[model samples]
Target: MSGSGSRTAAARAAVGAVWSSVTSACWRHWPTWAGWAAGGFSLLYGLLGLYWTAGGDGFPFAPVDPARASGSILEGSRVEVVAPIIAVLGLVGAVVAWLMTRRARPGRRSAAALMVFGWAAAIGLTVIVPDYTLIILVAFAPLLLVFAFTGVPGDQGGIGDILYWHRTNLIIVFVGGLLWATATLAYRRRARGACASCGRRHEEGGGPSRQTLLRWGRWAVAVACLAPLPYEITRIAWYLGHPLGVTPDFLRMMQDTPGMLEVGLGCALASALGGVLTHGLVARWGETYPRWIWFKAGRRVPPTLAIVPASIVAVTIIPAGLMFLWTSEARGTWAMYVPSLFWTVWGVALGVATIAYHLRRRGACRHCGQGPQPGPEPRTSLDQRQVRDDPVSAPGQRA
Candidate 1:
């Protein structure tokens, strides 16, 4: 009993220690990113917006005919109306972002206003304006490079032809939206009187506790795991010689296309792998390397190893799903795009799960000298000793 308890205690302590240290292993990290991305970038982009308002040529949001417009809300927006709005918002956003990141925290109402605007801009640029075009570009970028070497079967427009200035303009806008969103989070941490970097308070109540996040994250992980299953199923069916959603005539056409089965198999394998990796969000192996791994076994996994790729995939999924739903070649055909019904749900859930994973493992704030919140498990030698002596409690609670 004592031996088993000792091992349990060791594992628990090790997990806590490694999680706590994650914050320290960094590359000249900022206290909270300080809204620089939001403020500075907004200021620069706003100037461009003003230029576009004048007579600048590259205004990406010029009004399009409604029927031709895909799902993007920005379609049919006049340059005269759009440019000035972007200019004003960009100018105003710079000021708001600056105030948000200041050392002196703003009043409750002021902070609330800042957060509202920041989040609104984030959603507008990220979800409302952009369409599935971005999704196709990102997903097929690698393929384009490959095609560059082997040469596509048909006329392959190089990257420049496909990713014209218009699409690139939208990409830049998406990046701006991300900056504002992050700025909002940093501002919230500072305004709450917590450590800006880690958001840990000297006393409790900086925000939701670790336990709360864990509970919420579990649901998010479940949703994420399931969301991609539909897409995977459809692809797998095609690979197995039984096209699930496509009609026989359509399937024949697709089969006639070169590398059709290969492409379907590739997509299936990718989604399947993505789902499995997402499962690690709440698994023990996510916290530390398992014994099966060679040299690095038993060591704490670097948080970035899981976070970076997960973030990229999640970001890509959202717009692609939106595009499929709103306007695509599959508009009349249910079989082509029906499986993507839950893609947005998957992307959202994955994002939430990633946030929860960060919160759970990011030990304490080095700047403020905070630490992991106390767990229900026994801590001290005396506490462990007592539990060991008492057979009923010797096992203690799971970490």
Candidate 2:
């Protein structure tokens, strides 16, 4: 009985040690813990809102009668069905966020699972609430102007008009972006710490010198970045009563709409701004903060800060560009075909530039601004034997 009691005590002690370690780690990284808690709470709130909507009660902020709620062809009752699915997703996301906080590196499996879930939520919500999705996409890529202007059936409203009325979907898009960004950042952090060749902890090095490929990559990025300018200019001209390459009927239709000119002008300005930002990827300011910024001037830029958003944009735009290419080819619009090709090229170029930047910056040691220096070689057995046998003949000895 005494031996069994001792064994139980030992087990309890081991579990206590583990718990202490976890608590200590959590205390040290309290911000990460707080973020997880916030995410969980937000998800719970979303689920609650959905539940309230599903139960024939109006949402707290925006009340609508249950009979007036939109019905879904696939599920019969949109609120009743989608709310439960989203609630399940939210629960899973909350659990995953908690698990991520417990470890320094969530394994590849966890990262993959999180990515899958994030994308699923993003896509599902986009399909169900397209207006919100359109707005989010527009914010990211103004080139989506074509789709935004397309008319929706039975509503006598353009896609933009319908989206304007359904503003609640913005919350869903925001949550989806958060989930995806978190998962992606976690995965990138793990990847950065490990060596690509041996999967070992990488010591700092002056990586590859600036090569021809890198120079070409910079130029490609510049060209691709500026490619959107022509499309923007054409649209602006069309809106301003100087039609360029567009039919008179189309221009007339656009001119009749309120704020259409303003929208085109906004898209043009946004494209120009995006082009300027893209140049920073290959510029000196990309490595060291520009002097214009008082606080962060001369400070080294974090690689992930640039890489993450660029990666997301590349991933999204590449597929969209491909679809545009297919549709433009079918319609035989050479003007559209040329501009759509630029989008795909821009995505590819941005990705390449980001990779080059990472490679250039990743080699410096955090402690020293230089690559890892070679350590002194240890004496081999042969050298040791030689020194022992003839100390006088050893290097630095006078015979």
Best by lDDT: 1
Model 1 regions lying over 4 Å from their true place = 1-34, 63-71, 133-154, 205-215, 241-243, 373-399
Cα lDDT of candidate 1 equals 0.74
Q: TM-scores of all models?
A: 0.77, 0.51
- Tell me the whole-model lDDT of each prediction, alpha carbons only: 0.74, 0.55
lDDT of 1 by residue, 1-399 (tens): 999999999999999989778755532255446487778878887888899899898777665444334455565568898888888988998998888778886899988999999899888777666766666666678887887777655554556555565667778777888888777877888889876667777788546665677677778999999888877887787767786777877777777888887787787787888788887877656755666786665566788888887787777678767766656567555657877767788889999999888876676565776876534433335344334422332365535
CA error at residue 251 for candidate 1, angstroms: 2.5
Off by over 4 Å in 2: 1-42, 49-53, 56-77, 104-115, 118-165, 187-200, 203-223, 226-230, 240-246, 257-259, 283-355, 358-399
